[model samples]
Structures are given as C-alpha cells and as structure tokens.
Target chain A: MPLALYTVILTQIHSSNKVVQIFGTINMSVYSSQRIALIGLGTIGISMAALHLSRESNIVDVFDTRPDFEQYIHKTLPIYMSELPSPNTDPRSSPESQPSTSLVASLVSSGRLRIHSTLESACASATIVQEQGPENVDWKQTTWTRIEAVAPSSAHFWTSTSGIAASIQQAKMQDKSRLLVVHPFNPPNIMPLLEIVPAPETSAERVEFAREYFSLPGSRHRPVVIRKEIPGFVGNRLAFALLREACYLVQEDVVDAKDLDTILMASLGPRWAGNGVFESYQYGGGEGGISSFLNKLGGTMQTIWDGQGRINVEGDERTEWKEKVIAQVNEAYGTVSAEQIQIKEARLKDIIGIQMKDYNRHGPEV
Target chain B: MPLALYTVILTQIHSSNKVVQIFGTINMSVYSSQRIALIGLGTIGISMAALHLSRESNIVDVFDTRPDFEQYIHKTLPIYMSELPSPNTDPRSSPESQPSTSLVASLVSSGRLRIHSTLESACASATIVQEQGPENVDWKQTTWTRIEAVAPSSAHFWTSTSGIAASIQQAKMQDKSRLLVVHPFNPPNIMPLLEIVPAPETSAERVEFAREYFSLPGSRHRPVVIRKEIPGFVGNRLAFALLREACYLVQEDVVDAKDLDTILMASLGPRWAGNGVFESYQYGGGEGGISSFLNKLGGTMQTIWDGQGRINVEGDERTEWKEKVIAQVNEAYGTVSAEQIQIKEARLKDIIGIQMKDYNRHGPEV
Candidate 1:
C-alpha cells in the first residue's frame, strides 16, 4: 500500500444534492458534519466504524463492554479497512487493492475514531447510534433504553442483531420509531450485505433515509429493505434452507461435504452470484421466462421437496450428523487453515467487487 | 479471439502422462485417436460436443432425433464452444473472449464435428458413447440397447439423465457395467459440474475412468462421483431446497422476489462461489471450526427449520405461488429481456472464469 495522506477530506452527501468542502489540518482532527456513534465495538460495530473511516469525512465514537476492545480495534480494524474495494476504481472488471493502511493510521492519530468509556458518552450527541451489543433480549432492551435516553431524540437508532426483531428490542424504548435492525452479514465493512429490516413502527422516512445513507456515492454496501422481520430474516432463511438439505445429503451419503461444495461452486455459485434463483430460472425457461420454467420443472421441484430430508440440528440426530460432517469435511479438506481462510476471504471480496463494479456501470439491478 | 486454426490438432491424454501429439489438417478432419460418440444432440449433446471440440484433438460423432439438428449445431454449437474458458489463458485474473467464430466455421467445414442420421451410425465405431436422449425411460433403454449392440464392446457408455437411475436405464442392456449416468448440469460446455452417478452394478474402474475423462488437462469440468443415485441428483436437490424456502417466504409475504434475489446475490452468492457450504460454515464457526458453529447456532437453525413452511408445487398451491412470483418478478425486473439475459450470462461466465483462474493458480481443489 502506498502512503496516501489524509490532508484532504471530502464528505459525500447521500442524496441528489452534492456538497463538497475542504478541511485543513486545523480541523482534520475534528469530526465531520455527520457524527455516527457506533456503540458496542464488536464485529459489527468495528466494521461499521471502519466503513465510515474509509470515507474520510466522518467521526465515530465507539464503546464496548470488553476492556481490550480499543487495542483489538487498533490491531484488527486495519485489516477490514484494507480489504475494502478501492474507491473510484478505474478498472471495471477486476478488484484492485488500495493503500488504506496509512490512511487508517492517520485517522487513528487524528482521533477521528474516538473511544468512549461509557455508552452515555458515546450517544451524547449522535446523529446515528448503531448498537451491536450482546444478542440477549434483556441486554438489548436495556441498552436501547439507555442509548435512547442519552442520544438525541432525532438520532437514528440502529441494531445489528441478526434474528431479534427490532420491535422487541424497541419495546422498552421511548422513541420506538427511531430504532430498527441494521444487520450486517459479518465483518460489516467487508461484506456488502447490510440488511435494513424495519419494524412495523419504524418510520418509512427513516427506512428510506437509511437506504440512501448506506448507499452513498461509490459506496460498496448493498442495503436490502426486508419488508418484515421474519425469524432468520430473508438472507439466513434462504441460506439455512439450502444448508439443511446440504447436511441431509451428507448424512444420507449421497455425496460428501467436499463433493457437495465442488458441485455447488461449479454450478449454482456463479449462477446465484450473477442472477440469483428466479432470474436464473427465467433464463432456464428459455424465451418463456420464469413462467415457462415453473410450468416445465415445478413438478420435479415438488418431488424433490417431498423427498427432501429434514435435518434435525438438535438432539441425537445433531450428534450423528455432526460426526459424519466433521469427519468428511476433515477427511476431504482437513481442518480449515488460515491460508485457506485468507484465500477464501480474498475471493469473496473479489467477486463482491466485481458485482459492485457491474452495479455501477450497468446499474445492475435486482 | 485470435484466429487460431485447427491446422494442427493435439490430442491431450486425460491422465498423468499428459501426452500431446500434433496432427496436420489432413489428419485433423479424421478426428483424434479418441473418438467420442455423442448420441442425441439436444442441449446436453450440443454442449458436450462443443466442450470436446474446444480441444482440437477431440472428434465428437453426433446424432439427434430432430431433423434440423445439423443446421442447429452449425448455428448453436459455436456459441457454446466460444463460451468455454480459453485454452492456456495467461492473465489468470479476468476472462478474455476469443475469436472462435472462424474456428467453429473451420471445424464445421473440415467435417470435424460429424453428424449422423442414426444413433447407430454415430456410435458404431466410437471409443466412448455419451447418451443425452429424451427423459423417457423406454427411449433411454432402447437407445442404450441399440448403442451397446453397435458401439465397440469396450466403449464407455455414459448417460446424461438427471433423475432416471443408471440401473433402470441399463436394465435392458447386455453390458450393464459399461453404462452409467454422467449427467452435466445444463450446457455441458459452459458448466463444470459433471456428476458421475454410478449404480451398484457400475464398476469402480469405470467410475474412476469417467472422473479422469471429464477432468482432463486444463479441463473446466468439475466432476463429482455420487455414491448413489438420489432424486434431482445433488445440484438440483440443493437448489430446489433453497428455492422452496424462497417460495415459502414469498408466499408468507416476507419478501418479494427481487428483494429475495438481492439478499442472496449480495450475501450468499459470493460466499458460496468462493468457499461453498461446509467451508463457508467452517469460517462462520470462527476458531472452534464447524463443530463450534453447529453448537452455537444449531438451536436457532432448529427453530427456523420447525417454523419453515412447505411450498407445495404439485397442486393449487403451485398456481397461487406461481401467480405471486410471476407478478412480482415481472414488476420488479420487467420481462426478462434479451439484453438482461445477455448481461446475466456474461456475469455468470465472468465469475466462473474467476473461480477457474483461482483454481489454476491456487490449485483450488474441492
């Protein structure tokens, strides 16, 4: 990574109106107009902060219960920042690595990413409060209540919970409309799947506001507005349903774990990465679109469904399946190594970069 | 797409020997030493022929029930062959298109891709006979019987059936051990997922032989040997399971088709494309590995499983779900236009190319 100075900071407006201003070193240490208070700096919180820092025009006050989180951020957050797709990339096809390490170091030195000892201090004047604390319902309720009391009334409250409905988390809150789940898949800044799941009470205005904020100019994040808060939500439900059958296949000895993955990576992986299921089938239907596809193959789908095994992830079945999967996964690929994980992460980032580039050039829609 | 000629054809040995022998155009039209008889030139047959022809060394004898099949191959086979990843590509990063039209024209003019009026004529003197006839059982049985009677006694008999067990297809044949299901997903040339599903009677030697054949040097195909023939084989079953949950979610009004697709394309697509199911979960499990993941999230998975709704595609529910999906898909994406289809195909190919490049560089194995 080249040494790129943070001498100039530009704040990109999230709407039709574009505003730009220059800040000198005198105000370089000072935060930008947007004060995003990211509470509970675990996976989601740290990642969100890194994303904000990448913009060079935001300030994030972060706090977590863990005492060593500050040090952890110093060590770990740079990796996430570095993996982010290069901004204003000239190449539209392949992903290019950006020199983000020095920029992160500069931001850290300038105190743009402030550390707060108390949650109240973090939420004191936050424009947006993103909470990614423990998954415990009681902890979430209490945390929201506390943050709401300290945070400005106009602050946009966001939770990073995966399964917990925002309505439940906001039950004890005074301003229910302000709170909603802004769940990121994991390592928030890197993976672009930021699901903005609004509770029934969450104002439509805020949902739209979030849609714009997370999807700023040149932003890589793909924020999806899930209409309702179904358990596991849309993404996880889709993933686990596929996984259940995957596990069942392994258990049935139809194919081992590695073979199953090879089959998928070769076929469905690229298919979904490009068009997803419905559109892929639309193509499968030939000129008839998805309608033709359902007519031709829907019956077979039903047969497969009826015959699909229900994997019991609990009790003895879990034990039996686990033994089988672990042995097979280990046997085929052995224990996952850091090199393997690194390569996997690199490829994931590259594909996402390719998608984002297409999204930019072709306005690649859903 | 340089105008690389078939003036020199090389037969690549599909094993450790990696033999390469060049022949002049006088010998090129005569085909390579390995004569592959492709019975039934529909989707699978045309694609398999294209894949084989990509290697100048391969001579595929083709036959189809359709009367206009010869013209169809002249027009359609080029497209499939063109889409196959370029041979000995240097970049190892992005896909580069080749000037394959002239090459295909040359191959056709040279009579390298031979078309037969009868299946017997196509398979009569072949070293390997791959059958991709209609889905009807009787048709498959009759076709196999005819091919087995005329095809060389030692010729490998392979079927491209999706569901029918090899045992059932070979029931009427004398040499049952010689025949098995070597199904390729959709277009065999473009897709690499070739499942070699052998029945109880299929010799282990034959299974290994099929594996070696499909996974030849620099071959794009990734073949998986299914221990047993299961419904939908493996790929379709996994896909339909995911699609089932997808339909259920749409039926419950949890999300529309486009949003469901957006959620998947943004999250699971790249994840699976890069690492696949078990491998992705291995990373998902963090340091403790997949065991830790099952232990931590197994309960939530069970809850999601219990609450999951079954989508019945065989009855009234099919109509209801179909109406909902068709409307939503059309509304969100409009009718799938040819341009849309083209872009989708390009992206899919690009991602697959990226994966293949990684496979080559990292020696990426299942």
Candidate 2:
C-alpha cells in the first residue's frame, strides 16, 4: 500500500472494528487473537492482562517472578473487569456473544490466558511483548535483551515506562525497530491515551503497527505516535504544567487545596473532558475560531504564564512549596488508604465509561 | 441566626434542596423565587435569563441596550435550554411540575419573565441582580452606579466579568459589599461552575447568599468562592499554564496542535473531568497517598515545569510565538464557525449532563 493510503487506513480504523488486512502484512481480526507475552505483573501489567485476556480472541501468555502470580491475577482480574464498560454496549457498533463463565475463569480454564513457569517459556511462541517491569534503566535494557534471546525475532516489544525514553531501553536490543515506549496514563487498560515513543532507530512501519495494535478490540487506548522524544512526553508534561500552577496557588494561600480541586472539578475539569483546551478556547473565540481566540487572549495567557508560582524545586527533600502542599493535601483529603484508591478507581472507571458511551453514540470528537 | 449556624446551613444546603429559611432572614424554598434582574443580553446574559426563567418560581427581569434584546433572547434561549440536562432529571432530587409550553414561551407569555423597556424599570423591583454587561471597566462602573440609583438598596450584585476585578468595578458604588463578581465559565446557564469573587469590602454574608442563589432550581452551577482576587482567577490561570506549555511544544515541533489536543482529550481532560488534579495526584500516590506521589514524582514535575514553553508576551500586537501557534491552530482545526461551536456546546452539555446525572445518582463527591 502507498504510505498515504496506509496512514488513511489507520485513521479510518479509529471508528470501525472489522478485520483489517494489509495484503502483504498480517491479518488483524476483530479481536486479533495474537499470542501476546506479558513480562511483568505490576498494576499496569495486571490491568493489561485482564483487558487482553477478556477479549475472547486473544491468547495471552504471562510470566512473573512472584510465587503467587496466578492467584494474584485470579483475584485482581475480576475487580478490574468489573469496572470496564459492558462489552458491545455501543448500539452503533457490532455486537458479539459473551462466554457463559466469568471472563477470567473462561480464559484460564480454556488456557487462552496462560501462565508460563519461565520467562523463556512465556516468550517462546509470542509475537508481541508488553513489558511492565520495574522502572529501572538497567533492568529494562537487560530484560529486552533476554526476551530477544528467546522470543521471535519479529516479536514487537513495548514498555510501560513513564519516565524512561525508548532509545535508552532499546539500545541493547538487536532489532531496535521492534522496541519502543507505549507509556500509558497509569493503568494501561483503562486510560485512552497511549504515548507511542519510538527510538530514533525504530521504524515508521512499526510505529503505525503499534498505533493500530494498541487500538485493537477490548482496548480504550488511543495511540498517539509521538513525533520525537521529549521529557515526560505530552500528557505528563501538560499535567505537570497545571500541577505547578496549582501548587503555587495553594502555597500562596490563594485557595485551599480542597477548593482548588473543587474549582477544577466544577469548571476546567468538565470543560476539558468534553473539549480539548485548544478547541474549548476556539469555542470561546465565538465565530472567529482559534486564530481569533489566540489573537485576543494570547496577551492575557502570556501575562498569567509569567505570573505563575515558581515551584521548580530540584531536590527530593521537601521544598517549602511541597511541604505546604503535602500538609494541605493531608488536611483536605486525610490519610488516603487502599480503599480510598479503590473508591477513586471506581469513580474514574465510571467517568471514563460515561465518556466512552458518549464517544460511541456521538463519535469520539463529540 | 448566629453566624456559625448561617455558615453551616449554607454547606448543608449543598445536599438538600428543601426550603432553607433563616428565622430572621428571607425564606428560600426549593425554587427561591427570587426576583432576578439581568443587565445586558449578550450570550452569557441570554443564557442566564433562560436558566433563571425556566425555574417555575423565578420572576426574571432583563434589559439590554441592544434594540433586539427581547427578540434575541426569544431565539437564543431555546437553543441553550436544549443543551442543559432536562430539568429535575435527577431521580435523587425532588420532583417538580413542568410548564406545558416551551419554557421561554410559558415564562414570557406570563409576567414571570419580564423584559423591561429600560434598565431602571428592570432593576426597579429586583432583589438580586445578575449583570452580564460588556467587558469594560468604565462601562461596568457606570452601569452599576446607574442600577444602584434605581434598584432596591438591598439588592445583591453579581457580574460575569472574566477580567477587571470586582473591587475596581465596585469602587464607584455606594454599596460595594453587594457587588461581587460571580464569574461563570462562558455560557452561564449550562456550565456548572460559578466563581464567586469578592472584593475586600464585600461582606461574608453576601458570599454565602451568592453561592446559594446561583445554585438554586434549574441551575447546574456549583459555586466555588475565591478567597482572593488573583488575576484570571483559578480556573483560567490553570488553563493558561497548560496552554502556554502546549503552545511551546507545538512551536518546538515536538507535536502538532491537533495531537496535543488529542493527547489531552484522550487522557487529562476526561481524567480531570471525573477527578480533580489534586485528588487525581493523590490517587496516583496509591496507598502512600499524596505525600508519596509528591516525594516520588515531585522532582520530575519540577523538571518539566522548569522546561515549559514561555509564551507570556505582553501587548496586544502579534508575537512570533502567537503567530506560529495561530498558523498551527488554523492548520489543525481549519476555520472554526458558529455551526462548529454549536456542535461542541451540544457535546459539552451532554458531557456535563452525563456528569451531573452520575453526580446525582452517587453524591457529588462520589
């Protein structure tokens, strides 16, 4: 296919779930039942496994050093799956039959969701790898090299590293083009954003493949192939920008931490949820659109940016800014426990579910 | 009522919509029935009128210099109303009667929704005034002074000014305490936030009154009282911080403006929609809570902030940064139009409706 046609196909696939064939390439069915290897069992890894295994067409292989990896997933998979939107809930999309038993039970019993005794065993038949290992530089480099030794030479490698760039992670690998960063927003399964950061050596074709593959069935992930590596990628960088200003406001006693959260939840939060910052401002521009908004508000925006509280502390030791903020956070939210995380995750899931449903009914941009 | 009791009652009112009467003060039923006068008939003013007029008990009075103000509201209101969640849709909230005719027709045909021939006539009987006048300091000062000359001396004031602090606007007024900024996020009727900004002279009692008043029947508003009058206030300040960084990234060719928006819409937008930045960070902290998150990621956050794009340019004329960003914006979204905005607003209303419904079913905090 022409490169232009290939790009168009990828964009077009955003709305449909039919089996996509590239003639000379692989066949990607609705579920794309590929042999997938999950190398780690962190929260992200577990979430990814649950999502992949639940898709009836996937054959997920896993290996974790933990003695109780099977029991761990057995207990956690159900909890994660419970929060996901019911499959085929979108009336606009095609529907498929669900298995009679619990998804985890059915997958496990049928051996579609397999646990290998060794890393080599897990990678032996795998065509794809999702490595959510420890966030250490040396650890990732060594792990990828070992996986390469056993896994298929053609097996594509992905990492969930939030901070590390893919170039560093793929340095030791022989097939550099196959390895890259597909960092997610915390839980890999739920958040729709996947920052696809390919190393300098990674191929363009592989980037498209990663984008299409991550966006396959049973995934809410919308892959954005990052043009070039930047620190913190896109989402975190944007998040930290807001976070820095929030920290400054609280430090200055402009508003309490709780009120800061309340203000965002009431206004900017929901506004952005439905519309992007740029588009929201474009709407604010009235009939003139974005250029008009930029021309009119660019000065005010610049003024606010100049006045933002400086909270760029370099060390790990608590800056007075961080100290005041953490104190406020505790005072406002109290000592958050595991149950607190559970409650928030549930709410986040429901929030995303509502978004996805609307996304299905009116399309994603709507 | 004692001051302590008065404050407690305001907080309590958040959960219940029953008649909240302070023995010595005025009675506030579920639908306060407050006689509200709206000055100016711009988009904000028209939307505010629609919201206020829809409530069964409100006696809405509106006036604007534009000769077509009456005809404009007649045509614009129904569109805004269409975007709001259906009145009393929350099953958890008490049921209310609906007028048989279209809300605008029913209210206008009756004396309940009055469009006065002059500003003096509109404010003549109004107990609470919602001013959505043009964005000018002198215009506001003169308008408020004029309204105060005729309106009830006891009338409380609210302005929809995004800039020009209330203190500056109220400097010329006799009762500065009554005229604080109850700034709404764009279209006041549909968006759920009302930023209550008080001048130093503004009394505490008026703050609570504005809070309860804006949040009455047929309103989706959740008021957050600004502790101090910072420039751009909280929501806009946070928004600009993110925008500045986005502009920088796009300018630097790290990402296109469209992809930047895609990253946000897919991740942070919806994440923050369901969760506040602080609360979300606290969740990211896991069992360790906000303190852990701060300790672990604070350094990285600081680094990102230190490197954020600085686009804070003063003066209204075009800046290179602004030019690049505008070119990119036009390139990405094409020419934005009135029709485009309508689509977005409809989507925004649905997003907020979904949010509000969830909020009702499981308390706001849930």
Index of the highest-lDDT prediction: 1
Report the alpha-carbon TM-score of model 2 versus the true structure. Answer: 0.87
Fnat of each prediction? 0.72, 0.68
What is the C-alpha local distance difference test score of candidate 1?
0.76
* Stretches > 4 Å off in candidate 1: A1-32, A88-111, A317-319, A359-366, B1-32, B87-111, B317-319, B358-366
Interface RMSD of 2: 2.3
Expressed as tens digits, the lDDT of each residue in B1-366 for candidate 1 is 111232122322324355444333222232335678998778788788877777776677888878787677777777676666765653324445543556656775786777888888888888789988788899988888888889988788899988788999999999788888888875455677998999889877668667867776777889899998887899999999999888888887888898888888898888888877888787788877788888888878888988877868778654467779887776776666766665666666667767854522456543
Query: Which 10 consecutive positions of candidate 2 chain A have the poorest summed lDDT?
Result: A91-100
Which interface RMSD values do the candidates have, in the order shown?
2.0, 2.3
**Model 2 segments beyond 4 Å from truth?**
A1-33, A54-57, A81-85, A88-111, A316-318, A336-343, A357-366, B1-33, B78-84, B87-109, B313-319, B337-342, B358-365
lDDT of 1 by residue, A134-196 (tens): 888999998898998888887888888987899999999877888878888854555778889
DockQ in order? 0.53, 0.55
TM-score of chain B of each: 0.84, 0.86
> Residue B215's C-alpha lDDT in candidate 2?
66
